[model samples]
Target: MSVKGQYSATIVIGVCGVGKTSVGHALALALNADFIEADDYHSAENLKAMASGIPLSDEMRLPWLKTLAEAAEAARQKRPVVMACSALKRSYRDLLRDKIGKVQFVFLHGDRDMIADRLVKRADHFMPVSLLDSQIATLEPPTSQEDVIAVDVALPKTEIVDIVARTMRTRQNADMTALNSEH
Candidate 1:
C-alpha cells in the first residue's frame, strides 16, 4: 500500500522509558499526523498492576492490544497516525498489523542502564521503575521481516523524529514507485 503524503500510520515501540512517547509526539507533529498513546488505552486494572510494579501477562494485555489496534485502524482511515506503544513481542506487533494493514514501526532502542536511568527520573507515570527489567525481558527486537525502522534512543528527540519522518517518506516513495511500475 502507498502511504505517501498524510495517509500513513506508524507505531513507535520500545521498552518502558525508551522515549517512545516523546519521539512519537515529535514524529506526529513533524508528519502532521494524529498522535495516540497506547498506554492511554490500557484498562484500569492493567494500570493498577503496572503501578504496583507488577508486569502484565500476555493474556492480560490482549484486550489492550486489540483496543490500540482498533484505534490505529480508525485513525488511519482519515489521516496518518503515530502511536506510542510498548509492543515488546513479535506476536504483539503481529496482532496490531493483523488488525490494521501496512503499518510502519519505529523501534526506539537504548542501553538498559540508560533506559533504567530515564525510568528512575520519570515522575507521575503509572509504570514503575521496578518493572523496567520485566519490560526489557519481554522485548523482542524487530527483525528485518517486521518492516521496522530501529532508531537509537540516545539521540535528541527532535533528531529521532526527523530520522523517522525521513525514513517514512523514503519508504512511501519506494512503495509508490513499485506500485506504479506494476501497472
Candidate 2:
C-alpha cells in the first residue's frame, strides 16, 4: 500500500491477509520504524470467536483496539512506528484518534476474490478463511478527511513496498529538512 508522505507514524489497515503485516514490516524496515501486529493483543475470547469463524462484535474489538493504541503511543515515543491493524471501522480508528493524532494511514484495499485468494494461501493464523466474509462486511474505507493513502492490493509486493517507502521517505525527509532550516 502507498502512504501519505510527511507523517511520523503510520498504521497499515486492511482486512486479514490483505498484506497488512507483510507490508507493514517492509515499510517499517524502510523507515527504520518499529512494527506491531494488532492481532498479537487479541483477547482469548476474540481469538475464540475468530477461530470459530464467528465474527467479533464492536464490544469485543474495543479493548483490543485500545491495546493497539497504547502500543502505538509507546512506539511513537521512540521512533516512527508502523502498526498493522485491521482498523475496519471508523469508530475503532476514532478510538485511537487522540493517542495518534496527525497519523497517516496506508489502506490496502481489494475485492472479495483477492482477499479469498490470499486467505487460501495464508496459513497458521488463528482467524480462519471462513471469517473473511464477515471481515469484509465490516470494513469501511478511509475517506478524504482521514489523511489516508489507498492502494489496490493487487500490486506486486516489491512494487507496493517501493511505492510506500519512497512516499514516506520523501515526506519525512522534507519535514526533517524543514526543521533543520528552522534550527
Candidate 3:
C-alpha cells in the first residue's frame, strides 16, 4: 500500500447490512491504513430520515457523499484510507473518484435474503431494515471499467479482509510495474 505520497483510498461499498464496517476496519488494519466510517459523516437530517424509514433522495445524499470524499482526502494525507460507504450509485462513485484520485473499491455483494438476515440482527443503527430494498434497487454494481473488486458478503470477515488486502497488494504491484515501465 502507498503510505504517504501516493493517492490511495479504498471504499468498501454495499448495502447497509453487508458488514462494511467490519470488513473496512479489518482491511485498514491489514494495510496499516486509516479507517473512515462513512456513516459518521452523515448529517443529522439524513440520519433522521433514515431512522424514520424514509429513503434519502439523491439530492439529500449529495452533501453526505461530498463530506465523505473530503474526509477520505484528509485521512489520505497521512496514509491510505479504507472507508465504509454504501456508494450505491455509479454517479456517487464517479464523484468520489473525481474528488480523490486513484480511488479503489471493494463491493460486498450478496443475496437479499442473506443481507436481510444480517440486518435483522442489528439493533444499534439508525438505518431501518425496510430501506434495504431501496438501497439494493439503487445499487449500480461496479463494472470492469471501474477500479473495483467484488467480494461475496457470505464469506467470513477474516477471509474477506485477507482477500481484499491481497488484491490491493496485487493492484499496487501492477501499478508500480506500469509506472516503472513508463519510466
Candidate number of the best lDDT: 3
Model 3, 17: alpha-carbon shift in Å? 0.4
Flag regions of model 1 displaced more than 4 Å. 1-8
lDDT of 3 by residue, 1-183 (tens): 343324469999988999999999999899889999999999999999999999989999999999998999888988889999999999999999889887788999998999998899998889888999999988899997887999998899999998988887787788778887777
Residue-wise C-alpha lDDT for candidate 1, range 1-183, written one tens digit per residue: 434333346899999999989888888889888999999999999999999999999999999999998898888878889999999999999998888777789999999999999998999999888998998889899999988999999998888888888888887888788878877
lDDT of 3: 0.89
Residue 30 CA displacement from its true place in model 3, Å: 0.5
Which ranking of candidates, highest lDDT first? Answer: 3, 1, 2
lDDT of 2 by residue, 1-183 (tens): 113334646899988889999999988888789998888999999999898889999989888988888888887878888989999998877776656766778899888887888888887888788888888889998897876778888998777878887776676788678877776
Clashes of each: 0, 0, 0
TM-score of model 1 (CA atoms):
0.95
Flag regions of model 3 displaced more than 4 Å.
Answer: 1-7
Q: State the TM-score for model 3.
A: 0.95
Give the distance in Å from residue 178's predicted Cα in candidate 2 to where it truly belongs: 9.2
